[model samples]
Target chain A: MAETVLSSGEKIFILHGIDADFRNDGRRRCEYRSMEIETKLMPQTHGSARLHIGNTDILVGIKVELDIPHADKPNEGKLEFFVDCSATATPAFEGKGGDDLATEISNVLIAAYQTRNAFDLKTLCILPHKKCWKIYVDVLILQCGGNLFDAVGIAVKAALNSTEIPKITAATLDGGEPDIELSDDCIQLDTSNYPIIITLCKIGDNYIVDPTLEEEVCSTSSIVMSVLPNGKISSVVKLGCGSIQFNTFTKMLQMGEIIGLKLNKTLMDVLKEENQFGRQRRIFGFLK
Target chain B: MPVDQRRINGPEVSVPYHIYSDFNKKSDKVKHDFSKRSDKRIDSEIRKIFLKTGIVSQAKGSAYIEMGNTKVVCSVFDPRELSNKNGYCMQGEIYCEFKFAPFSCQKRKIHQQNAEEKQYSLILQRALEPAVCLHEFPNFQVDVYVMVLDNAGSSLAAAIMAASTALANAGVPMFGLVTASTIGIYGNHYLMDPTDTEEAICNTQPDNEDDFNHGIITLASLPQHNQISEVFLIGSIDTNTIKQATEILTAANKDICPVLQQCLVKTIMKLHNEKK
Candidate 1:
């Protein structure tokens, strides 16, 4: 008896529709809802972005704080992802209800951004072993439209691209305590080569990308594919119940590859264009 | 785009950005120095308060308030079911959550509720409990979520005003409207309705962090009965300042009583018109 109580008849009807290769909303297996993206809404943070895909509103903010690099990876900076499903969105996420979902999403993000191929971490290191910047990419889920994986990934990447880490004017070693001066104007972090996630929902016969909530309920299985900008799979893991056949899984990988490449190109173009027209970024927050 | 309120600044050599690396001391001073304005008023002077009702199209009843820099949006959720396993429905429950958007301050915060937010939420719960009619809606809970979009200062007091407004908005029966405000004590001067930059901080760093503890007072009142619904204190302050702030805040909040009542009156009138 989950909170979402879809009738048995409705569930059956959804399954039947999936068999015929069409969803209830008349969307093809590979269609997404309308998406709107806005960046730098939070003037207090280093970088911030909010994305609304249907009713699902996701906000991602990145803060660059000085810290010592990892003992194992001294030359590389650090990136940590934390997701909070606030109760303002839904009562279901009250108290500790959203912890499991937060952990799942954060774990996936950590795995996806593990390698330099997906995201460059070395540039974050200010000095060899002394100090580096740890970018905390915190995601707040204001609404729970389905296909959260894709929405979060897209928002995180956009926020990262919009992140302006203050340029270090000078770093001097004086009497064991290092003194670092930051530039007046904050400089945008170079994340033009970040990764994007594509979720493939295994409907009855066909695989759907970016499935809606109603569609998510009908699907038997789904796989979240984190596709990097270099046209390689960063991580591929299955989610939800049921299983996909080997042949269909391979086909999804292929479809994901094609979609992934196109997605990367368009995303970069949007980000670059948004940055180019920067002065006009008048933040219209939720009030509007 | 509400283009009128925005300030688009060009590049500058010295922005006077205040960095707060240490705790127990008030943060740095930025552009919005209320004390040095043309009025020559001290920082503690509260702005003229106003309350409007029946503004929200969707809510049953509603009220809007402005207190200098602290702009809060509050909506009363429900006199609905108590979903949690643990519940004593004899008296209604009051749930208060205080949130400050990352962009609400000069420094952009990561999109997470830090420890301070939790403390604020608890403070809200304490301040609001007295005003809410907990026994009226038993076997139910009312939720108040205060969203601070643009935090200029004294958000907690604003939150109290918001909760009362939201309760009226939801058509929930209540004892009376409540108004709240904060008073700041700096040096020999006292300030009312301190902004985010002035939140419980010393103007200068102390030789010992524990030495300088400026006093802060938060007060919420029900005007008709002269009932003090909520009161909270933070930092350090002398007895005279506390007594003075209470008097000033009570006087100010008493004036706001009609604004909240007007909302309820409008809501009642609207319902009556609908019935007719």
Candidate 2:
């Protein structure tokens, strides 16, 4: 939890603006700031993407390794998420200061992708109980303006879209052991049903989406909802140290669903349009 | 002269022996009858709850609760100076530890905290943070520990209820009492305080592709204030079910408030009799 000390006057000003449905920025109550996404930035990893929402910057890299499947879930592969909060983001994240927030974010991402509709883990399985591909998703938080959950979710989906899993040429059982072969060809993973998270911050009697760093300090509580592309919510978790009335909670959920669906469509269109360029897309890196 | 290092030191993998018993075969992947549960309870009926406070003599406050086969015990320690001084703070903090006995579940649990337990601890803290008045003891910390002796299902919900009662028994200042409930949704059926088998079935992917919405939701709310302290939902559920589940859970939470109040009243009466 990064703290930005604000005078009582400053807090009142922000709260009043939100109560009137006008944010400090020129966005509406349900509007999000402009976002920029770039994929395939790291050549060494199987997939990589960088996402920027205002000053909040996140980098996601994915790697695949051959491994055995779990005993109970032998038919499905594994997806592990690790989040690293860089000290450069804020001094508060130094050492183990960010472990709590990092674990919370990673666990939420895992829950969002746990369902079959959101992500079909069976696709990553190579063998029934012997061999499978384990996908490791590492998220690096380079900066945190606000709305870290949504930014991380969108970046993860983009990185998964660009991932290329090498094809298996042949497989055979050699006595007790199994033999497998690989080819140069690679196949892309399916990311159509992936979910995008939308966070709604409750300020005063009204709830707003995508609160800025300063505005985050003014809100009482916020809810994070991960909505699938098909308009179904995968998971929801209430954050912040505040209580919410029953009616207000339901209203926030409804608002979150609407905003999440819109965000998903926009992100998919952007990713599809980028795919059309097919390696010809310009690499912007960190530069503007 | 060298030992056989190639051969594994132990079996490649060890599994529980109960999986081979006849009991497991009888109910393997059977399409659950939504009308009546295994315990003969209706879909919306929760199991009988037995709640008591002041179970631990040494702790400042303690409570133990049982909902059918699930048993949870919570203890709250006194407020002490913050161990890790991170600058000056105006409000107090809470440290929560949630654990399960090795034999609590069907499978054995290790002594070290697992990822699932860690997440539960964090969720417990969030659920209780708003209900407890932390400003009363600034720059100090209150430690709350919850251990599940038997986890049939809905362990987190049971822990939340017990911990709140323990906090109150400790005589700590608080805004209002908190209670929690869990609901398992399978298709259109909403099973209140589901059992272990029911929870597993609901959590699994829907067999027929026609139905895709199923999962669990645990909600903790402050009934006196008419506000929800925490709402945690998992699995893929549509918005309509979410709305229904929230309503049902809120009512369920309110129903348990009177029971807790009765328990607290009984405890006070016993103390008064001893003092006289």
Candidate 3:
């Protein structure tokens, strides 16, 4: 992640701005930075999306493969998350410097999507215990501005929505030997229930959403909440060295749920519109 | 059961079915004519090169280059104090890190730098070190990071070209611009700037024992100085054939020099206009 060195005066300014519910960029406390998303950009992957939220750029590619289901959950598929913080983001992320942050982000994603309400793993099952579709959601962090969790969550949701898993045409157990045939038609994954993470950075006495790099420096602690479209909180992780009161933690959770639901709705609507436009939609990856 | 936590779980090992099928279909579609290459390019014709500098605002100098489908972005940060400064050295150090995006190639690249990427990074550093005047900033190191957004072919050559432009754009003192190109030799025919498909075809093991002259030769040269900085050759090839390939590669590098110079000039002009 890229770090911004801010003076005491600058930090105080950001804290006061957050306390007043007016950020430096004039965004409201819960307002998000304008984001741009393009799906199906990487033709190499089964499903791919490039998202730009402020300066935090993320590219999510979902690759689907057939594999045996877990013994405990023989009928369900697997959704694995891999986050790669590229060295291009910053010199600090060179070599193994970014692996810790990458693992933390990926673990949050895995925990958020673990529940059945958030994501139905069984939907990816091919033939009960025999075979299942393993969805590898690989997230590549190109640049880090701030609010990386929110940006990565949104990108993952959009990528999953655009994912087209191959439809199974035939499956049979002939003479005790399993046989399967895949069709040309691809089935789009159901992402309506997908969860989006909302990171609320605690600045002063108030918590702000989508903190920029400068604002992030002023914040003492942050809470990351993954909320589904149904307003269900899937997971919550507290970050930073600062601690908060019990009441403030609950308040943050409530705020995250409300904002996360709204965010998910808007994301789905945008994704639907893009799909409707189909080939006519302009795709601006890094070129823009 | 105790979990083995020493090693992280890597990607699954399986054939990329979609890419394999697509590759087979594409190769089957192409006529197995030895004389004519795919994409209708002559044996010595290179792909169209698009190069630009100063793409990354945060970095001191950056460049973006697209050779057909292969897109590589290189950024050079300002020289910083060396962390392991045991003793003062006369010349500065250059650190190059090369990475291919997970979705860049037909197969998904892991997050970590694999052996091939590490090798490419060293190759790029060797190619650019000769062009830079390192002694100007002693006890400091300049970092050059190159990311391949898309890998069609000749990505190493593209990375070298992009890094040199980026270093120059950063106002780093340099002797001259460095340009690179890759040539694939299949039997007696030499293909310039072979695409991924073409390279794959040329790399396939020949069934006939006599047709053993298949390989890729990447040449990085200082065009103004008329010097070859680095030569990377993969696969087996006879000495005479390598000599011919080097000639073609050197000629290709000469042709690419002007493009690099033009891109650097444009970047400078843009900066000047912005200042005004």
- What are the chain A TM-scores of the candidates, in order? 0.93, 0.98, 0.97
Error of 3 at B65 (Å): 60
Q: In angstroms, how far off is A72's CA in candidate 1?
A: 2.3
For all the models shown, what interface RMSD does each have?
25.0, 6.7, 25.9
Show model 3 residue runs off by greater than 4 Å: B1-276
Candidate 2, B105: how far from true, in Å? 1.4
Which candidate achieves the best lDDT against the true structure? Answer: 2
lDDT (Cα, tens digit) per residue for candidate 2, span B65-174: 99999999999999999755477678998889999987999877766676778789989998999999999988888999999999999999999999999999999899
Q: In the order shown, what is each candidate's alpha-carbon RMSD?
A: 20.4, 3.8, 22.2
lDDT of 3 by residue, B163-232 (tens): 9999999999999999999987776779899888777766543543533556677878788877666666
On a 0 to 100 scale, what is the lDDT of residue B227 in model 3? 64
Between candidates 1 and 2, the DockQ winner: 2
Relative to the true structure, how large is the alpha-carbon lDDT of every model? 0.69, 0.89, 0.81
Candidates 1 and 3, the one with greater lDDT: 3
Share of native interface contacts recovered by each model: 0.00, 0.71, 0.00
Q: Which candidate has the top score in DockQ? A: 2
Write model 2 residue lDDT over A21-118, tens digit each, in one string: 78788778988999999999998899999999988999999999999888667778999999998888999899988888888898899889988888
Each prediction's TM-score against the native?
0.51, 0.96, 0.53
On TM-score, the leading prediction is 2
lDDT of 1 by residue, B1-276 (tens): 001223434332222244323322323342235447433556646765555555666654455667765677776665678876754657777777778877787655434555446546655665566566777888787777777777877777887887787776777776667777777655455677775556534232222332232545677776765756545554333334445656777887787677677766776788799999
Which sections of candidate 2 miss by over 4 Å?
B1-14, B17-27, B208-211
